[model samples]
Target: MADRIVVAGVPVDTRHWIGGRRVASVETFTDHSPVDGQPIGEIARGGPAEAVAAVAAARDAFPAWAATPRAERARILHAIADGVDKRVEELAIVETTDNGALLRSHRRGVMPRVAHNFRFFADWLLRLDHDDFETRGHTNHVSWDPAGPCVLITPWNAPLMLATWKVAPALAAGNTVVLKPAEWSPLTASLLADIAAEAGLPAGVLNVVQGYGAEVGDALTSHPDVRRISFTGSVPTARRIAASAAANLTPLSLELGGKSPLLVFADADLELAVELAVEQYDNAGQVCLAGTRLLVEESVASEFTRRFVEKAAALTQGDPRDEGTDIGPNIHPRQLEKIDGFVQRALGAGARAVIGGRRKGGQYYEPTLLTHVA
Candidate 1:
């Protein structure tokens, strides 16, 4: 890993904001730096005890927060957005180091998009109003109200930004949160918790736990006090969380992965088409919105395939921290292997490798493109 980030600032001894700052039981987990497959930091993983405690804290904080006016909540959201802007570079660095994303890339590409989400949702919340009318011969006003305490389970792909997506909206709607970031990159979540604390958020209005989903996620999902869950990840894992939430009749917002379609027409700019296909593969095609399954008009398939292969061949695969590279190593060795297998299986099934078709190292795979891929 070429980027050396400060990790000693993370809280490794205890979880905060429960029982008036009482300590909780802690176990250690080695958070790997995906750029080099090394232990970047030691995060103390919280278990059932800590999970329940965080839930209880958020639940305890919900009533007061929910009672707060919408405009007041919006004011706090503005503060959070300003807080995010103040530490954009730091968050970018921590996010890149924790998840193999290029900090500069995120700052240039993703953070701006995230800031737009916050502003859009913030405006949306303020504009939401009640409809006062007489319907069915009755007088009533239907108004939007805050959903109570919530738990957000976010993946590591865009840890800080995605958490902000949930946090900004939830806070704007006057709901308190308990976030469980993937154990791979829990440090960013802790950093957000610190920011929220400094922003003068009331104790327990926002809490974060570091741990595996099986123990911590299950505990938070099933805790009688939790009002809702919003999760993002693999469809299979989401199904499991859905099942767990069902037992409690808990409201769950699901955004499982989507297989996006990229269509290249006959008259399309070959250079632009190829550029798009290659660029979409950044993050090594790990994003839920990655335009993975391309469907080109058969008339231009051959030309498009050739151009796509040539462009993909130009992508440099190495450490994200390295400034010259356009693509980086996969987030984990297993993910690297999984993508390799996908290539191989496609090859075995007669999917022609238009460009790269081999692995470089344990964690670095080639910038590959395939055609006749099913």
Candidate 2:
């Protein structure tokens, strides 16, 4: 019941979202699930060449789409929000399958965040307008024009949520968009794109290009037609997009990698703190804002780490789809391998795993808690 089960009917043609239609028949790619090493879906394995074509499509659609009135755009967004509401269950299934996240997380966290996001951005459209003023000797005013078309790069950790953040704002601002979802998770993004189409959003106004970040993402950044770039991913990749965007002087919006730490003062509630800590590690630390590092007061570090390790040890692991499973496979096998390599090197250099530090299968990594990481 949670598989979206209808993914087979979803379009897989590596077509460009242009002028409110699907322009297919060129090239494509496959989308896989990290949890089981299964081919869950397919996407367009687009490259620099395709980027040129997609950007051209968006470029052509931009002026007209942007010139549309704010209220009209707002109406389209409201329609989109409505459509998303209808597809919440389906979207949640695909989301869980793609990222190996807890279904409850998607059902509760992802879907609601998406609904709130669309409506939230929909409301902003009402608040947007040009202002007029008078200077001492002459009239003075400032007006904002749509920044032409934008190419947004989203991440796998929080695909729909991150992409929605960019898509909602850009659409409300009257800018047409060309989005490249993380190769690791495109189901939700593709589904959202489908919903936008159903909502009657002009085709090229919101295009979905599913491919590698370097291939599809780079092309859009370097393409002259794309005037803005919004990327959410690793720092190295963000740096590349930023530098490339500079060539065209295209503006950028980036949410890059961060080594986040959470501090628990001695006076903090130990019970709640332990619960949240376990929850953080349960998702396999794939989330960007996850409390990857804990900076507990030295007085409580020993006791805190002990309880955290105990919780991590008891976490259930296996197929993400199982109801009783508390943990799922890492979203990417390579990512899991990377984590292993990092932890291994740290251990070789004296870091210790108080709880777990082993790879079970292709995508499943133990819910691990390492101490004294160097």
The top-ranked prediction according to TM-score is 1
Q: lDDT score, residue 123, model 2?
A: 89
Tens-digit lDDT string for candidate 1 (1-374):
11123552433332433423534344667778787788875566677888888888887888898888777777666666677677767666666777887656877877666566666677888899877889799999877677788989998788878887887788778888888888777767766776666666788888887778887788888887778899988888798888888888999998887887888888888788878777787776678888888889999988887777767666777778777777776777777878888889989999987667888875777777777765
Candidate 2's residue-wise lDDT over 1-374, tens digit each?
Answer: 12232442443233445456654435555667776688874455667766776787788888888899888888888898898788777777777777888777777778878878878987877876667877787887777688888999898887887899999989888888888888888778767777898898986888877678767787888888888888888889988998998998887888877777877889999778988888876666787778888788888888988887777677778776667778887888679879999889888988788877888877877777778865
Against the true structure, what is every candidate's RMSD? 3.2, 3.2
Worst 10 residues of 1 by lDDT: 1-10
Model 2 residue 25 distance off true place after TM-score fit, in angstroms: 5.2
Candidate 1 global TM-score: 0.91
User: In model 2, what lDDT does residue 341 have?
Assistant: 95
lDDT of 2: 0.78
| Stretches of model 2 off by over 4 angstroms after superposition | 1-16, 129-142
